[model samples]
Target: MRLSRSLAFAALFLLSLTTASVAGPGRITLPAEVTATGQVIRLGDIAVLEGPATAALGDLTLGPAPAAGESRTLEGARVLDALRRAGADLAAITYTIPPVIRVRRASQEVSEAAVRQILEGFLAEALGAGAADAELKSVELPGPIRIPAGPYTARVVPPADRPLLGRVRLGLEFTVEDRPVKSVWVTADIGVYGPVVVATRAVARGDTLAAADLTTERRDLSQTGRSVLTDTVDAAGRIARAPLVPYTPVRRDQLVLPADIHRGDVVLLVAERGRLRITAPGEAREDGTRGQQVHVLNRLSRKDLVGHVVDGSTVAVDF
Candidate 1:
């Protein structure tokens, strides 16, 4: 008997729940202006529905919102169309009508981390091929970067513009899908760096380079062109063509090979043809490095002959 009574009570409880679900909520009241909490704005979310309206549209489906920071008005013909779609008998009901119903998108709060991520990616792209290994020095923004938060994306405004060089103001456009929402301007301190050879101390022109005079260091790649050597071996023993400052990048154009033959020095002039080799004492007319062509005066013949400097002692002359 107790079991039968409990079963009967359970059946009654289920019936009430079904009846309430079928009836839905009481008449919903819609304000003159409704702020949308999500992507879609529905009648159930924005309006107050009474028995008839509630029965007509248990849930009214409106289209998507206009934009993230914008609003859309639905009334008159639009409202009538929605009612028809909801299977409501518009002609039979004489309900109070308002001038218009406005649906607004709620302002979304943007986090600082989100904006920083965008700026970082933007600066990385500016590095081009070096982006993967490029190290950022510092990034600065003129003002707070904030935008209406939702499904959105960020990109360089012009797209075809040059990369951010040194410190400059940059423009980035934020979009929702394909629609543009806002543009943000910020200052960027971008730098791309790599290893380069730098002088350790001030050295005068014509001074020969030594290993202790140079050290490898990281510098902006933009300033370090192909003329800059990364290794001290290439720079060592080379004569300085210009005054090198301490801690400054050493460029290839700033150094030259030491001269092997000095001008006005006496050197042996050699002439050879297969096994026919002859030598004569001569004076160098101009300073020359090994393998360089220079004028040699034959001391006995008193004639200037062009020959290649072989070393500190010899200059090879033909004929």
Candidate 2:
């Protein structure tokens, strides 16, 4: 009986030992308080120092390598490895984390509109790692940061050995605003009767009259000669405007003529008055009032001249 019992116990112990050794290949053994020691992996003769991690991995281990023509997710593996390297304390690590992204196309202050990139990473937790370093950066959280709303930059550094290499973040920024110009108005004189002027050219709101504006006539001639009289019409567009300046000393830049006048610049004899005789005999076709002198043809002279016809046959000259 004693011999049989001894054999049974030995068998059970052997069975327990065997069971402890294996669990579908993955459960790696790591002492409860073991400092991470990095691994030097070999690819043929080349060796790469991988990581120093205290991983408490479960039922998952390296499987067979992919066949020569197989395609795989490089981004996925890269992200996984990055996370694995980040959290060296393994037993505590459970869920997978979002990838750390480096954004290059972003806009920031100082560097105005241009091709920019903002590096970013999604952390399962903020980890609150403040800023990133030159070679690496920390991904910033989503939401508005800084001016000119846009991509926030950051970098990711997988923890090597020393004190969990800190994370870093930066924001892209810029400035902009709307600007405008000024508009002006044209100066003009508007009234009920239209632009007002006199024999004295109307005073433009802010203007000084000079010598040319005055008119004076001396050595009056009874004989009529062709001459021009300019005048300005009203808003009615009628040319019936009367002469503003008579014979006088029309000064230079003075208020002598109408504000506007440039028309039938010819003289004609029409009528006469008292002892003072004007242009000679002429047909009183239009607006030929008595005192209005105009041009008339002298039958003897056969030429047009200014004269006042006292009656049907009698005529006088204002020469």
Candidate 3:
């Protein structure tokens, strides 16, 4: 009976040793404070793991990391619960240290000057070939921005509805690892220089513009409220609708097309009904450009009519 008891006791001791070897001498130590550089906090980030079984648990994700320039605290109990959920053998592992852990995410600041430089480059690219003569009058930023410590890309989004010249507002977007983190508004004043037509001499309202009457000059097109004529050919032979002073920019709206048909001139009145056409001699009562409607008197019928001016001497009428 004594020999059988000894054999059973020895067997039990050997089994215990085998079980300990399988579980491993696992140990975990938590620090009071930690810093994280990634987007998420991992077990290894806040805790030191010893032994084979516990070392593997270090890769387990704890939770989302705090935003840059910010910190968050985690409790010991919560961490233990997470470990337990991850199927960690609690009874076989030993833990040492803090009841709570504080974690801070590493960050960096984007300076105002850097932002201005970025916007300048963006503006230059937006202007394309015209950027060579473009001037940046002013740049306004919303101040510095803080973000996670890592490489990032910045994109300047211009307003799609209009051009980038004059006082313009743009959106500045920062993306890290292909994920958008923040956005800001930036404003700038831009001036684009280009040639514009200017009146060389005082031009009356009814005076026709001639090559000698207008000249080209370089000016800031942004300040011009109306679209200015760029070439003398666009203004030549066109009648002025408003009085233009010398050395002043000539705008497209200030000019009108020369009259094609004048009052009291004889015109060929044409009428079309189905495929049949009729023609009569008529007298125009009002000056009009081609395609303009004018009052006319048909000589054959001696009746008043309104017709579209086709040319300097022809008008079309509907019967």
Candidate RMSDs in Å, in order, are 11.4, 28.1, 9.3
Residue-wise C-alpha lDDT for candidate 1, range 160-252, written one tens digit per residue: 555454555667787764667667775555566777898899999999889898899988865566588888999999999999998888899
Clashing pairs in 3: none
Cα deviation of 207, candidate 3, in Å: 2.5
lDDT, model 2: 0.30
Tell me the tens digit of each residue's lDDT in model 3 across 1-319. Answer: 9999999999999999877765677888888888887889998877788887696797788888898889999887888888999999888887775788898988889887777788879867887888987888888877768888889889999999978788889898988878787888988888888888999999999999989998999988888754888889999999999999998889999998899999999999999999999999999999999999999999999999999999999999989
Query: Candidate 3: lDDT of 179?
Result: 79
- lDDT for model 1, please: 0.75
Per-model TM-score on C-alpha atoms: 0.53, 0.14, 0.75
lDDT of 1 at 85: 75
| lDDT by candidate, in order shown | 0.75, 0.30, 0.88
Ordering by TM-score: 3, 1, 2
TM-score of 2: 0.14
Best by TM-score: 3
For residues 1-319, what per-residue lDDT tens digits would candidate 2 score against the true structure? 9999999999999999767544222232321121111121111111111233322332122222222122222233543464365543435333332232221211223221121132223221222343222122223334323222233233333224422223322233222222111111111111111112233443332243344443233321111111322233211122223333434322223323222211222233434467765443233322222333445554444575554434433334544
- Model 2 residue 240 CA deviation (Å) reads 15
Q: Residue 309 in candidate 3 has what lDDT?
A: 95
Q: Which candidate would rank higher by lDDT, 1 or 2?
A: 1
